[model samples]
Target: MLRRVLVELRRPQTPAGLAARLGVEREVLEAMLASLERRGYAGLAYPESPTCGVSCRACSLKNLCPAAASEAPQSPPVWRLTALGEQFVESAAEGG
Candidate 1:
């Protein structure tokens, strides 16, 4: 399941979108995301700046964006895999 989460996180995604994709509750998914973050497997997509560059509706990833994560999102952070996470995914793919 952790591997699956990392795989899905190849692209930026929100807690709610990820939860729905994984068939888990938002709270449960957040816990999992936290764990991955602690291990350097996942992290914020826009750590240096805010991600809301364009209006929500015009964004290509709107469906996976923080704004779409909830009815009301105050610049919710989007999650993505870190370098370590990419290594993990690569190793997993190679069955290492």
Candidate 2:
């Protein structure tokens, strides 16, 4: 389940979307996301348009993005891969 979540999150998607994709409850997926975040393997998507520079990656507001919910009907924040998360996916795909 963890690996599947990690790989699927390579692209940004709403939490609800992710849960549906994995056939899990939103709360279940959210707990996994939070765990991955604490381990530095995943992160929240930036609400605003991508900005240049490394600082943008570490912005305190990264987890508080409002634009994530701007989509029609509103939804939870999107999840995305971190450097570590990407590495994990690549290695898994390569059969590491």
Candidate 3:
């Protein structure tokens, strides 16, 4: 399931999109995403700026950005494959 998730993440996608594509619940997908992030397999396409925090509500990118694992907003975050993740995907494609 984790590998399938990684394969789907080759392109940027919101959590909702991912969930729908994988046929899983949003909450379950979020948990998997969090696990991948912790293991350095995947991460945010655009991480929140250092200055941004709880005040995301006031930030102009509030609707454009996805919060880290700590905050599981219903709004999807754009997730991407990390370097190692990409390599893994490529290797898998080559039947490695």
Model 3 per-residue lDDT tens digits across residues 1-96: 999999998775788889999999999999999999888878776444322333445644455445533354334457767777878899999999
On residues 1-96, what C-alpha lDDT tens digit does candidate 2 reach at each position?
Answer: 999998888666778888999999998999999999898787766434322113434554444444343542334566777778888899989999
Better of 1 and 2 by lDDT: 1
Please provide TM-scores, in order, for all candidate models, with all chains considered together: 0.71, 0.71, 0.68
Winner of 2 and 3 under lDDT: 3
lDDT of 1 by residue, 30-51 (tens): 9999999888788766423233
lDDT of 3 at 61: 46
Q: lDDT of each prediction vs. the true structure?
A: 0.72, 0.70, 0.72
**Per-residue lDDT value at 36 in model 2:** 90
Ten residues in a row with the worst lDDT in model 2?
A: 47-56
Single out the weakest 10-residue window by summed lDDT for candidate 3: 46-55
For model 3, state the Cα shift of residue 25 in Å.
Answer: 0.3
